[model samples]
Target: MTATAELVVDAGRRIAQDHPESPLAIAGLTVRYGDKPVLFGVDYATPPGAMLAIIGPNGAGKSTLIKAALGIVPKVTGEVTLFGRPQAQERHRIAYVPQRAGVDWDFPATVLDVVLMGLYREMGLWRFTGARHRKTALDCLERVGMRNFADRQIGQLSGGQQQRVFLARALAQDAELYVMDEPFAGVDAATERAIITVLKELNARGKTIICVHHDLATVAEYFTHVLIVNMHKIAEGPVAEAFTEANLQAAYGGRLSGAQVTRLAGASS
Candidate 1:
């Protein structure tokens, strides 16, 4: 690792020890596809009850960072912890909502069936879905305004409706920390508002949410903290402090167009 990478890793360790109550901590995270590295030593820690936005340009490894932390993709080197424990030990406390495009919407399953899958971790491998599980799933759907579509097939819903279904499933998990990737991408305005409202409610309840968000316009409005990355950790902290024009420039490498910057400034204002 380079000296900068070493420093980033060391800083992560210190932050983790100092803020031992953090819901998520990642150190020296590196991932490679074939011989090419996607993420070079990256480190980050999410403050308790924070709504953190992980943002960067296309191919910046934003999604890879989340996937590596969750062990969905193999990492070259890294340490990931949840609530001061190894992620494996605290898996039940974490909920993941992958990007919509990453899923096959045509899968033949009812909305209720998909939501009920979230309870499998609590139900154990041998237990079957029962009345209580069904009720919980229904309630989660209701929370996302999808209760009426519980019987609908997953492929039959619109993009926004599908996003709601995914969110409801995550709610059903009832995890303390939520890691979502591009939940707002391709969604209707109403769906976006609904997701924000639900996320705010979760934050109010002390649940930590970390989203790999693409929309620069909504970062300040929706998230409490921001993690800017372009192959490595560029900057991370409370949105007001860490997310700035300079940091955005550094992370985007001059690709953030003038209009986008203007919109970002307007949004943050």
Candidate 2:
């Protein structure tokens, strides 16, 4: 077991003790890509002021589950409710930070410009970014500790910087629920720490966060709630309880194999 992995597992155990309750609920949710099925009857819930990490092997429908919950993808069955209301009816209260790679950074936009788009829902189509909007955007950037780079071109920033800008944009939305896809991918350790800190602060403020995570080693530390998924959900609950060897085995199929399990178990222990 690596020292870092042990620390992460220990931290997760502590965080689980601090918070308990599910704020977002999904029931029998299924998503399809064209005629092919991606998600199959998945169900999960996240506690208020809690961080939920969704993990699975490649092509496991992790992204599909998130997009389905947000109504960004076509669902074949089931329902998604945020804070007891249908997601569709609560769009303004939900924020999404897509994978940094999913966006085009060279689109000739500044960091501040992208963050300000978060207020477009409230500002409407024709209205310009008024003083209130600008102030809100700046405040959001400050919250993520990126106020200094507010005016920089997004393409000029590093991977972590780009991720922070997206987070700032999500913050400017003032959403009660946040759904982020792979926020830690390819980011530096400092940037990862910064992002985690911001998420913790937001969770403390009563915002629910769900992230599609790929790093299995940090899953226990970065999230309080864990959802093990494949084409279907294997387990969902407190990280300490739900992120068990059995659940992981189920989610990963035979891919984890014997050697991988030993490695992961040592790390998780």
Candidate 3:
């Protein structure tokens, strides 16, 4: 086996023997663009049912970290496990929501059609979606308050509406763990509230959630745990403990200010 593969095997065994219930565990993860390293030996273990917020500045590899762990982007060296198994072995147990700007809104798919795509894994490659699939897709849309837009073209919707559609799609997947990249980016107040409510509900139902969050102000209010990163992990643990001014300074190089923290807290309330 490759060196990276061996690391993954060792990490998986260690995690199972130690943190057996951790929903997500990443160790010695590294990523590179050509020769430039983006993430270097990042490590984190997320507990089940926790709302995790990944906080970092631009170009800090926040999104890259998630993509690498999920195998959406190639990793240079790392070990990643979900529920004590390798990611490939537990693909169906995890759901990913990428940045909204990454999607081609002009794609010729309806809201319902996009949501139904979440079920493709369960449906297999050869089977067609039937009435049951449609119903489930519609129900997922309802949860996100986007059922009314079911038949609408995705490109015709507002940014928040488009985000809700994507959330519906992820919900339709019904995975135990959700990994999202900036779900709050560019969304309005109402949309943010709606998404948070849905996220809380999911957590209450025993799902683990990890979101790449840009707004540090809302970190304490929106997440139970925080992972501070800047190319490499700075700090990670309970929001009450790890989301401190000292850690923020270390991660963002003193960019976060006292006023910014107050504003973020006020915004969440």
Best by the lDDT measure = 1
Stronger candidate by TM-score (1 vs 2): 1
| Overall lDDT per candidate, in order of appearance | 0.89, 0.81, 0.87
Any runs in candidate 1 off by more than 4 Å, and if so which? Answer: 1-15
Per-residue lDDT tens digits for candidate 1, residues 1-269, read 46766676676576567656888888888899999889987877788999999999899999999999988999877778889877789899989999998889999899999999898787876788889999999999999999999999999999999999999999999999999999999999999999999999999999999999998888999999999999988999998888888888888877988667766856675
Q: Which regions of candidate 3 deviate over 4 angstroms?
A: 1-17, 258-269
Q: After superposition, how far is residue 39 of candidate 1 from its true place, in Å?
A: 0.8
TM-score each candidate: 0.93, 0.87, 0.92
Best by TM-score: 1
Error of 2 at 109 (Å): 1.1
Give the local distance difference test score of model 3.
0.87
Residue-level error in angstroms, candidate 3, position 104: 0.7
- Judged by lDDT relative to the true structure, which candidate is superior, 2 or 3? 3
Best-to-worst order by lDDT is 1, 3, 2
